[model samples]
Every structure is written in C-alpha cells, then in structure tokens.
Target: MLLYCFTSARTGEVHESTARRASAREKTAKESDEDLEARVMAACYKVYKEDVPLFFFNIFTFFLPLASADYAFRDYSSAHKILDAAEAYNIDPLENNILEVIHFEDSIRDVPLFRPLSELQVTKSTGRSRGADVFRKEFASLGHRSGYTRNVTIRSCRRWALMQVDKNYSKTARMKFASYVSRDTHSKHYAHPLSEVEGLANYLGIESRNDHIQNRRGMGMHHNP
Candidate 1:
C-alpha cells in the first residue's frame, strides 16, 4: 500500500504522518513477508529429523537460502497453504498463476501449519532440543571421534575463544560467552546441506522457488508460474 500511495498520490505528496507510518509499515510488512519461507525452511529441516537451535533456526539456517526474489514466498504460500487464509485475510497466491500447489493435501499433515503472523507471538525457549548432542557430534565427528589430532579439531572451536575472547575473559568472568558463540556458529553453518533439501523437494514433486531461477533464462520471463 505504501508503494501504491506514491503511485496513486495527488501531485505525489502525502501527509507527513502518512509518510512516516507508511515507511514503518513497509518495514513491518517486509518482516512479515519472511514468515512463509522461514516455515518452509523449517519444514525442510524437520524432514531431516535432526536437532537444531531454536528461535533463529526457524527463520534462517544454511538449509534454506533466503536468496530468492520477494515474490517467491508468495508463490509457495499460494499453493501449499503455508499461510492460514482465514486469519491472514489475504488474497489467494494462485489467483492468476499457472501453477497450483500440489505438494500439500487439502489437509496438511507432515509440515506444520501456522497461524497468521498477526495472531502469533514470539517467545524464547528455555531448553534446547534433545537432538542437540547429536547435532554437535555431527560437527565434531565430521572427521573423527577424537584421537589426539582429532581432539584438537573438535576442541578447536573452544580453543578459538582462548586466542580471541578468552584473553579478555581471563581478566574478567566472560569465558562462557565465548563458548556460546562457538557452539552457535557450528550449528548455523550447515543446517544440513541446502542441496539435500532441494533434492527432497524435487523427489516429492514440489515445485521450488529455486526452479524459477534456472528456468527463467532458458524459457523466458513468463515460463514459470
């Protein structure tokens, strides 16, 4: 609507308050725009059956690259019922598109169904997933379970703090903070390979937004829905 305000403005000048609130609203809208993809990526991770960090993991992980055009999420939302239509009070994603969502059933079962963003509240979880140990092991166990040299690589994440934050903490009481950063970084890096998830999408006959990128060139602009 903010974009439209300028396009439909009278002599291209809107009230100052309108301009201010519109800019804020645009930012808020952009934030809400991310909801669908975040869930889709979370769903991708869920299929992995591996544990992950809470909160930020749902919105971002190396698993789902939020690198697509803004319109891509809308495309998924339209077909897969990614957003609850009743509460979202939004238009249909497939209103004029050639592709219809075929991945989800009329009643979705595997993927989680979420309420509209307006009705949701964010909160921090006090506990990590039961699979966290498994996730950590996957990282440290990448090469070995630890045998001198292997121990160094696994402990390298912690040794990193000694040269960095540990020195400062040595003069204070903040060593734990450095440990937290290293643990979180390991989990964030390979939230399970992106290609693996995309491959799953292809196997399931779900048309992914990434497909648009590859096809857009060979088939021209309107080639994808």
Candidate 2:
C-alpha cells in the first residue's frame, strides 16, 4: 500500500500535514453523525411535543420535550417507538419538522459578535488561572444562550484558544493571526476581519496599553510581502 504524504510549504513538516488531513477527515465524519442525529431528534421532538415544523433539538436534548411538558422523547425505547409511529402515520418527517428547523436556525443566527478584550473580566470574577479557561467560560455563556445547540458555527468561539498563548493577549494576537492568515489567504477566519479589529478597538471601556491606536490596528503590516 502506498501511503499518501503531504508536505507543508511553510513548516516543511510532512507529518503535520498528514495529521491535519486525518483530523479534517475525523471532523467531517463527526459532523455527518451530528446531522443525522439532529434530523431524527427533530422528528421525534415534533411528534412528542407540538406540530411545529421547524424543530430544534437542543444540545441538551432532554430539554426539547421538557419545554412542551412532554416526556415521550426521554426514554430510548419511547423515542424509537415515536419514529415507528411517525412512519406508520405517513408523516414526512422532514416536512413535518419544519417549525423545529426554523427555530433551530434562529438559534444559530444568535451567535455572539466577538467580545472586546478590554471589557472581558473573566480573571477577576472566576480566579481562572489561564486565559484559555476564561475564553472557554465566555464561549460557554454563548453556547448556553444558543440553547446548547451543537449545530451552530461561531466565529469567536476560538478566541479563548488565542488567549491561551498569553494572558495579556490582545491586539498582538490579532496581528500574529493576520500575519499567519496573510501567508495563506485561504484562511480568512483565523484572522480578525478588518471591521472586527476596528470594532474591538472602539469598544468604550476597554483600556489600551499600546500607546498608538493605529499601531494596534496595523500590527501585521510589512512594507513588503
């Protein structure tokens, strides 16, 4: 068997490339499972709860039926029975689940805009040792608002990951990110969009230790590529 190898041009690390490809494949597979579960749970939620066509299966699945004061979806056996009943009743699970889908979509759209780093006070309140932990808490707060739905895509979810590298991580992190993404223009998400960087700098209460405002905004710029 010939093992395929991919080499990263930046790092010249062949192993890292293979590991990344493997990780992507794993993530794709996991997403497929989530999609299926979302569909099935949506259908089950509809029958057990209301006739709402757009069904949103909460990330905390147990809460979906509880919202309707219905417990039919709670038991594994009962859930399977509901699926059979829906099929027997000739219910088009997808069409019948429209209301649920709509609500679910709405929840997805509520993902928070990136928080201003200056306004964040996770360290004072929680006594969390690391910035990553602080960011995780912030992300969790966002998740809770989305009803703990796992299907949502969030831009700021990884902000905590960046905070992990340095507790005092601020615009410097964005600059480093921009440089990293600039090297490979394909990864726009990894870097702060120009607007986000600007919005962050403008948030009222956030203190700026960096003397020059323009420097913070233009940290990644180089005279030449």
Candidate 3:
C-alpha cells in the first residue's frame, strides 16, 4: 500500500488527472487565472494521503519551482511546504536547492521560508562542527597522521560524513571509496606472495609468469650487490 502511494506520488499521475479536470472546469467558467490556479492547487491537495512518503513530499514541494519560473512566482505554498518537508526529513539537498532559488529569485525571498534560512544555516553549521569534532577524535585515535593508515582513516571518515548528510548517496561510490582505500593500503604496506602475484598477472594479461620471478631475482641481486 505504501509502495502504491509512493508510486502515485512520484509519477504525479493522480496530480495530472486532477490538473486536467481543473482545466476542463476552467474552460467552462470565466474565472480569472489566479482563481483557476488556486482551485487546481486545492484539488491537488485533496488527493494527498496523510502518510505520503517523505521522498515524494520533498520532491513535490520544490520540484515545480525549480522546473518552472511561473510556478515559482505564484506558488508560495509550495515554497512553504518545501521548508517544512526539508526540515522534517533533514534533507540537505532539498533545503539547499530551495534556499538557493529563494536567495536569487528576490521576488519570493520575503516569504516565510526565507526567514528560516539563517536559523537553518546555524543548525547545519553546528551539526557539521559536531561531526568534525567526532572525526577529529577518531582520526587522532588512529595516530600518526602521515601514513597509509591515516589516509584510509580520513577517507572512511569522509564516507561516514557523506552518509550522514544524504541517505540517497550512491552505494557504488561508497564501495569504490572503500575498495580503493583498502587496495591502496594493502599494496603499499603488504607484500603479495609470488603465487598471488602470478595469479594477478595472469588475470591482468601481463606477459609470461616467469617475468615477475626474474624481476624479483634481479632486484634481490641488485640490492645484495
């Protein structure tokens, strides 16, 4: 049931139908543009379920404004909804984008949403500083900030911070960050066995396996001599 609600909200099929009906009514009436718009907005609200997913709510709140200048100019309600939804969901991207639009649009900045930006900024800064302090403690515990371990620790901390800020952050990016950090630290500090090297070389389509053995012997001889 929740999935169905999410799908309906995400696709805006229901809203589209409501809009079409509103248009039909508009054609029959001599209503002004503002009245027609208000009626449509009211119709859209009537279909909203109480348990609408935060994701859909967040998208619905600000997407219209970003997508259409005319909507942004006339839709203070959407702007207000975005402010409430963003705060409720702790969605930084939504908050940031809407704040940016309000900042530059000038025409709508005086609305109630604009007044909250300063408070939001302070709250975000405080949260970031708290995260930084926690990171510092964790990083300090790793000790000796100039080594491979330090680099890995830093990357891990950064990944954690990204997760905190955005729940929808890419899983592939997280995997890549982890994979690269692990591979780098292992390659730099741990020597692979000869069999492992030969297997890896074979996998990579490098020349005959004997080359690596011969190179190792050559390096050993050079060091000894």
Give me the candidate number with maximum TM-score: 1
lDDT at position 29, candidate 3: 82
- The TM-scores of all predictions, comma-separated, are 0.21, 0.20, 0.17
CA lDDT for candidate 1 = 0.30
RMSD of 3: 21.2
Best by lDDT: 3
Candidate 3 lDDT over 1-225, as tens digits, reads 122222312111221123344444546587655544322322222243324333454534543444233233333445556556457856555432433222123332222221112332322321111122333354455444433333233333333333332234455553353333353443343233333246666788986566666466324212111
Superposition error at 86 for model 3 (Å): 13
At residue 69, candidate 1 shows an lDDT of 16
- What is the C-alpha local distance difference test score of candidate 3? 0.35
TM-score of 3: 0.17
Candidate 2 overall lDDT versus native: 0.33
| Per-candidate alpha-carbon RMSD to the true structure | 23.3, 21.8, 21.2
In Å, residue 44's CA in model 3 sits off its true spot by 36
Worst 10 residues of 2 by lDDT: 1-10
The list of candidate 3 runs beyond 4 A from truth reads 1-80, 83-100, 104-128, 138-154, 157-225
Query: Which lDDT tens digits does candidate 1 get at residues 56-148?
Result: 233333212221111123235441233343236455434344222323222222222122333222122111121223333554554344322
Model 2: residues >4 Å from true position, as ranges? 1-51, 54-77, 91-135, 138-225
